[model samples]
Target: MVKSGKTKKKYHKPTKPHHHLNPPPAQANKPISVKTLPAHLVLEILYRTPVKSLVRFKSVSKSWFALINHPTFIKMHLDFNTSKNDKNKLICSCGYGTFIDIALLSLSEEPMNVLRINKDFTERPNYPRKINFRDFSKNMVLAGSVNGIVCLSHSEEMSERFVVLWNPSICCWCPIALVETKSWDNMSVGIGFDEVINDYKVICIVPEFRFEDYGWSRIEVYSTNQGSWEDVDKKGKIHFRPNTDLNHCNFIVNGVPYWAGLDLRPGYVDVLGRIDPFTGLFKKIEHPKHVRNEITRVNPVKLRESVAALIQSPGDYPNNVIDLYLLDENTTKWTKMYSIGPLVSGNVCEEMQIPQCFSTGEIILETWTWDTDQDHVTDLDLVHNIYDPKTKLVLHINHMQALHPCWYESYSHVESLVCIKGMVQIGKEHRDKKTKPKMKNWTEFLSKEFDSVLHL
Candidate 1:
């Protein structure tokens, strides 16, 4: 329902900025310098402040600046904010009409607006924000989002496709080098955060075709710290392509990017695949075997536990019922967590994509591609429903109405002060970049047997 228009990007101007994050309400009426505050109090205040506010705090004092920019403090802020229920904000994708608007949705009582990913950026010259990526909206695809950085990939007029890593919190972005492969058209790309090394890695999966069949998948990993891409392994036998669906439940857990495995070799393939960015190899795990006939109806997701799958209940209840199976990272065993529903209210849960859950157990559900006379909504925009399992009530938040085939997608994102390295001026200078571009063809596409999707 978010119409693509010539709207300028607007940052969330926190409604209650009347009181600064540093100076609490007790000192709200006066302009007290942060230097006057005690060291312990200053660190505590800065840790709780939002990223946008913390970015400006770099100008307060040399010590305050050093403290905020320090790796210890940044990690402290990210860890602290990760638990705050109200800190949750969703980066939901609006349709690609003339352009795509990746809007941020708040679970709290904040107003909603378009993120405006367009050509006009800020005052900095050659900033990446100025690039009009929407010109190729047809092939514009989201690789993945990790921490607070979202990586996007698109081919410019059938040329080679490149990757761009963006951190909207600080309005700083950098484009990763273009990935070229002999089987370029069949490659699947994803970006993930390797928490073990504190580095972000971009991975590409390509199935090598030989002897009239797919021999093996050649997997490559790009490390931000090293600023280059390299093959993860020479013999990756389970080199199946990960799911690349824009609306599927592909998520990253503990620095590993997981997508349901989809192989085109004409036999039964594993249901899930997880890549180890550090090691060049990966292992595939089967879906929860306890689901019986409901195995094919299951989807992998990150639940309250580390890695989990949502299984569609076999019962023909009034509404869709989903069960959760948490995979123990240590033991690699599935444990049944809970069920999603039992006709709690509406019957439109079948097409629900991702149900983003805040730290407070409040769930926001977005559904589409179905008709509903229960709500009497005559238009096409999916109803933004809030279902708090604790309260057991579905809160309807109907607003926008767009065309029938609106391709909006949403993913749960946690804001962080993560910074991108090798920042480049993105303007006319990019045209000078050259690479060994390979001819791509549409004959090689990931087999859509089980509808696996991309995750990072």
Candidate 2:
């Protein structure tokens, strides 16, 4: 019928079907052109999510990875996490020889719970087993605790010996070899996370090295995964030891470690050290500013995730307290936060006290009473004062009279036994939920267990 002279139209071979059904139009139900939201709003949403989700989102895109790793963003996220329910445990060890009396306290709720974990345990055949220093012929001291792992160092004949990693939860003990021979005079300890390897590391600093003699500091780092220790060569000509007395605690913020020491003068200044868990490299970070007092002791406490807090008393005595500064991760500048109340109010606050800081905004302070007017500060007894910064109220007050006998015996030189403020809280949990519970808090449950050990 139709003898068309015009060439018939030919359709090209069918390509792969993006969608197959009733052969709908190509642009059927296209994804909506979602408008990009402002970065602030996006950050707010990301910040509200749990740390697990935020960490997972880091791998979504290069933009996200860079954003999350940014110093400012890291600080904000850390602060938000710190404001949540944070639990910290305080451990106090007293005794010169092997038979040291160790006391454990829980700083969770308003009223602090103090439990002495020296009792005997049926599960542990070595109930209240006397830690014999004579066996090793060296005296051991509890250096510090991190994530429920305790560091213990001992010395004999003026030789600083090995350090051990003791986990109180499982009663498992792993001793690290003595990597250095220097005395423990100006030494401090800290543990932190390594994001690159997803493992934990412990750093020990002995400020006993002489800059004029060696022109370098003795910085040591330990990794759990590697099961070894290595020396960190960070400084060029700056001397760490012999410049000033080691006063502050070693603090860990956002997985980085830091401590307080003197700069050129006898005055105090903050010193930062980054531990590369992979290479075990310890490099010194520039101090933001120097404090006034020669005895400017820094109490570095973790107020939140990215916030490393410092409470510096202008002078050695507690009276001249001025400002509490929070360090910014991005600028690395210290910003003055709220002023803390007087160290002593003529209230129940006493001498030989330690302020136990937690991310929960609560400070667990240990106080002792002694006649300052007397010849020697020997008759001091122990007490605890718990304060909540949020409510600005005193939560609990208790006397640690059981530890008085040990204190009196060791009070010959109160300065050496004084616990510094930069000490990290033991039994702290990691951001990873998969990790095991490091702190057992066995004080309540294992009271009978530890009691038998001491009696034996």
Per-model C-alpha lDDT, please?
0.59, 0.48
Which prediction has the highest lDDT against the true structure? 1
* lDDT, model 2: 0.48
Model 1 per-residue lDDT tens digits across residues 376-408: 544444555666667677676544223113435
- TM of each candidate vs. truth: 0.70, 0.52
Off by over 4 Å in 2: 1-87, 94-99, 108-138, 157-159, 179-188, 207-211, 231-238, 242-249, 265-298, 306-322, 343-353, 368-382, 399-456
The candidate that achieves the highest TM-score relative to the unseen native structure? 1
Clashing pairs in 1: 243-452, 243-453, 243-454, 244-453, 244-454
Model 1, global lDDT: 0.59
- Locate the minimum summed-lDDT window of 10 residues in model 1: 447-456
- Per-residue lDDT of 282-331 in model 2, one digit per residue for the tens? 55545435356554545555554444444445545656353456767666
